[model samples]
Target: MINIVYRLKSPKFFEESIDEVELDGVIVRPTHLSICQADQRYYQGSRPANILDEKLPMALIHEAIGEVVFDSEGNFKSGDMVVMIPNTPFGEDVYSPNYSYSSKFRGSGFDGFTSDLVNLPEDRVVKIPDDFNLNVSAFIELISVAYQGISKFTQMAITPKDNLGVWGDGNLGFITALLLKELFPKSKVLVFGKHQENLNLFSFADEIYRIHDVDDDVVVDHAFECVGSSASQSAIDQIIDIINPQGTINLFGVSEYPVPINTRMVLEKGLTIQGNSRSDRVDFVGVVETLKQNPQLFEHLEKLITNICEINSLGDLKDAFDKDYISKFGKTILKWNI
Candidate 1:
């Protein structure tokens, strides 16, 4: 399997060129293939300094649900559908104390899931239930993220009656809203996005609007930031304006640069703030179990995936990533025919 590799800040389809060498005590297969956001970014020249130093070029596809075609150990068998989790941990680097879910992340300094036939560590993959659809099952990572946000606020001193608002109606926001509604059945969950078209995508929002509609006098109990941009900082200002005293604001979205936050308002309101990553193992398993027992509960998510890209080769992969036409819809996928 000729797979994409990142080296020296460049991404290329390297064919069986480096398989003869050993990497960090692990032998790699030359026939590997996979595709995901990580791969696209690397392919498009987005290289972090740390990754460049480590020579961290590997298969990239973190959000993947596929069948295991090879099993060196008895722990997995061919044809078993599984979700691949990245082995990269937050603690691997000296600067990871503040990161969330330090345990397992699929992509970023780790080999990803997009590959035609890539070798996987035995412990890095988890078997999906027989009834789960691999395409939909691939969304587990995203669902786990939403689960984490919901879990954090619920752990705080608030109940189902607390007022809740999510800023941004993107995939994360919608998922968080749905999760919040489940966790806090009675809380008012509103979604604010830049556009009304996005609001239509969220079936869980109690109310949706543009930023201009923000009522300066209204008090919100729970607020979430989902857009990972400096604009998210403005969300902090809005949170301070709308939240009641002692309310909580969850900063889920992150920006590349440090966005200015209103520290004084936070101090004055006595707001509880938190940053949540992926869900805990218990919560992850529980979400799977709940979906298994009540499959219909997540029927809405099926529609959320509005785009699917069947990746056959690097050309196909590049087209999907570069051409706006392919990504205009919601979630996109690269189906590997093994």
Candidate 2:
């Protein structure tokens, strides 16, 4: 089938390309898409010039939900609402394909969900309730990332989860803190951030504190650092100082450069640091099941949708990215009218 793919030909520049999509699997029409920090890095040319040169002219946006347009073998009916999984794995293995070198992730090096229609493997799409919030569902892939991290932490941590601290007040931090509350109801969920306005949105958390305002007496049994970039170092440092011994530190931040770790403190405190990246299919399934069981999660997730731009052309798409960059908090959702 003929498809229209909108790719970032250059920084702040997009061009359309004509491609033939094979009918080997399911074809989905993207309805709602969300902009991510990684997409912004490419749009703003913040990545190293060499890396940009290698990956540019690629279609962006991996977090999205769509309507099923076609499904081979009739496994799914037409017009079914489904969340498209971006991680295309080769086969099952002991380690997750999301962390494997063989996997091809959309919007990073491979083409994302920006085309007129996406022909994806049947296993890559999970059906969602038709009535679910489409805007919130657009970012389900992101929520799965947090789910993956928390799942790993719960499975490996031998210490108490009495107090859970989440650093950074952005979208990821909000989602992590909220999920922690839902998963560990008895635990005190504390959120630490610099932006008062952003931190205010995490109303579900048991406690909120400005990073600098945190009392010396306060501490958490575990910490999650969601602040990426150079600032992640600061959040990690603060976490190291306040986290209890044998605590698990979950790192979700994506930094271009390496963040320094106080190994002396890490050894003295016996902290376990785990790095979290993109999630696999199981994480997506778990998140979907969780959402179905706790329908109220949509209400909390709705607060993260700050900008909803309708995309009919490349100009509108550019406008949405520009708007997302300036906004201090929340997600910029693209209403895919194209």
CA lDDT, every prediction? Answer: 0.62, 0.94
Model 1, range 243-307, lDDT digits (tens) per residue?
A: 77777788888565788878898899787888775543445565677578667656767766665
**Model 1, residue 96: what's the lDDT?**
32
The window of 10 residues in a row where model 2 has the poorest summed lDDT is 89-98
What TM-score would each prediction reach against the true structure? 0.80, 0.98
Candidate achieving the largest lDDT = 2
lDDT of predicted model 1: 0.62
